[model samples]
Target: MTNSENLLEIRDLKVYFEVKGGILKRTVGHVKAVDGVNLSIKRGEILGLVGESGCGKTTVGRALLRLIPATEGTVYFNNQNIFKLKPSELKPLRSQMQLVFQDPYSSLDPRSRVGDIVGEGLRVHGVSNRGERHQRVLEALRMVGLQEHHMRRFPHEFSGGQRQRIGIARALVLNPSFIVCDEPVSALDVSIQSQVLNLLKDLQQTLDLTLLFIAHDMSVVEHLCNRVAVMYLGKIVEVADREELFRNPQHPYTQALMSAIPIADPKIKRQRIILQGDPPSPLNPPPGCRFHTRCQEVIDICSQVIPEQIDLGNQHFCACHRRQPVQEAATS
Candidate 1:
């Protein structure tokens, strides 16, 4: 699709943190949290980012909003390079992009009232008119199935699910076009997860909001996202339509991840692919394919050459030597 079709486009995004050690605490190495990730979110679709823990899913989300600095590459939001924007210039754009943090209990201020918590963005963005801001806050709360009475209460008073609703309301109050939902439902109970997921679905449809839903749960991605991107060791291994990825996972890592999903039907059993060895550390990620250490179908070239992203048609993409071996000349 054209650039006009996408609200956010990430090109070669990389986020690295300095790893300091010893008495002097000088930069010894870098933890490559996000390495050369390329992704796009359409105007009104939920794009799920799934991976194992410590794979840098959260780092990508944070980098998009400039919560954390990127070491390299560009994040184009409405065709504007956000990484190049100055602090003052980025302030207004903050309203257009918001984040729903993973833990609701910790995200909200215990000392503040619910109304104040949800309306904090408005206050920051220069909504000085108390009456107007109050109305907007109430409307936002109502949108998330919260009543006005709940607004006066503190964060400690609400249950985990209600606190999450407050967090969602906080994002909505800003009227953001794009939101990075960082495992919004993972902290809640299974029953509450469904409720919050349904709420997010309804809000996305009603507001035409685009989202980057970060999670490790395959079932949740299937339920809420339009497309799925499988990440490993700070790099995206495969990306495809949600249904397409689930039905035919291209990368070995993705296939292994899919195999772990619980099959509801006890009568039908599916083969499980257990990957050997643990994921390599980001500080010194294995050369070439990061999954080479644990990949079941490893080739000699896999250890020496990093795979290029291959377009398998119909917007499906995979980066694996097994899928299509990289030409030696291309790597040079």
Candidate 2:
């Protein structure tokens, strides 16, 4: 897609964290948290990234907002190179880009009142004048279905769901064009998750906001994302529209993930493709296709060389050496 059509474009993004090992104070290796991830977010679209834990879904979201420095590659926000911006030049852009982190309980300041926590962004961005910031905070709270009276209470006073709502409110108070929801609903009860998801959908449409919704739950991604990308061992295995992915998953990893989603119908039983062994550690990622070791239909090519993302009609992309055109629709 063209630059004007995309809200956020990330090309070959990589984030590595330095790690020390052995007793000699020697820098052993780096954790390849996000290794060569490439994706784009269209204006006002929810792009979901899904994978197992430690798969770098959260790290990609954090790196997009510069919460962590990227070791290599480019992050373009509205076609502007965000990494090139100096700290001062990036300050204004910060207000336009926000994050609603997971674990709302620890994310909020326990000592501060909810109002102050939510309004902190407004204050930092020089929306001085306490009255105006307070007004914005209340409005933001109301937007997230919280009352103004609740603002005076501490974070510990609210339930897990309410805490997440406050976190959403904090992100909203800045009136950002884009928001990274880093597994925002993962910590809440299943019943409460629907409430938060519906609220996010409502708010997205109301505000015309773009979002990068990261989660390990395929069910949650199917419910909220316009498109979904499956990740495995710090790499994107496949990316396609929601219906396309559900109906015609390309990669083996994506298929495995889709099969695990519980089927509601009693008569329609699904066959789960259980992968063998644990995922390889990012500190020393396996060469070539990371999923090859566990993939049931692995070919010789999968082990020796990395797969190139290929388009299989409809712009669906997959990076599996054994990926082939399906004669039938996805069973599950």
Candidate 3:
């Protein structure tokens, strides 16, 4: 179990990419990939970051690790402002923070064996003893259910599931306190997806890892995360505990998303929400509520002004013009 206090605090983080055009290649506009997102993660709990493709979920995860620079805002890891730290100061903190990328196949090198691939971080961080690195690599691989002999083989030699395990092993090798799991199982088969998620949960429990699980799949998030935050057009639409969010989603975008999760039993009747049209382009998103264009229950105020995040006690919050707390809305 983890403490209730936040281990990672992000405030008003923005990552806008300048778009250049014309023969002059002059900066025309900006892609607001991440726009003023705020979040906090406890020391050992898994926080799910969910949103549609191109909604900047991955960007948020990348920014938290400083893999991508933030145009504005601050990231505080355990009360230390990471962005203000110099390169030399940042180096030691790297082992404490790591990223398990989305594509396992592309992330690993074809030229390197499993041992070298997993130990690359140690090598870069000056863990120069080959003997020590080898032992650490073996231990990490074993933690993810890969055998010692498997370390001699290449990444291409393993199945999709095995390769993901290797990727998890790569992150674990550093013994990092925080990991950004950027849709680690999205490319795998359904059967393999659960296995990888389970492995991650088990490892988190064993090692007390704090994870930011980024994915578009709500079912996976529901299964693994203690709390879930729904993102829409770079802003967090809603955030609450997993059970509360699923049972009483407060935002229109979140309600539509939760409704789309495929259920196993056909006998159970659940309302299905089909959103029309694509999400607004990040290059030029809609004003006010970014989701106002696609929301089914759109109000006049939604199109005119941005809604403030309203608190409903118990840390549950949402940005919506019409939605009230679950109890009040239900009783009304």
Q: What are the lDDT scores of the predictions, listed in order? A: 0.94, 0.90, 0.91
Q: Candidate 3: what lDDT? A: 0.91
Model 1 ranges off by over 4 Å:
325-332
* Best-performing candidate as measured by TM-score: 1
Error of 2 at 69 (Å): 0.8
Clashing residue pairs found in predicted model 3: none
Which prediction has more favorable TM-score, 1 or 3? 1
Ranked candidates, highest TM-score first: 1, 3, 2
Worst-scoring 10-residue span by lDDT in model 3: 323-332
Candidate 2 runs further than 4 Å off = 324-332
Model 1 agreement with the true structure over 1-332: per-residue lDDT tens digits: 33999999999999999999999999999999999999999989999999999999999999989999999989999999999999999999999999999999899999999999998899999999999999999999999999999989999999999999999999999899999999999999999999999999999999999999999999999999999999999999999998899888989999999887777889878889977878899999999899999999998998999888997866789999888533446547
The predictions' CA RMSDs to the true structure, in order, are 3.1, 3.7, 3.1
153-259: candidate 3 lDDT, tens digit per residue: 99999999999999999999988999999999999999999899999999999999999999999999999999999999899999999989988888989989888
- Residue 95 displacement in candidate 2 (angstroms): 0.7
Candidate 2 accuracy as TM-score? 0.95
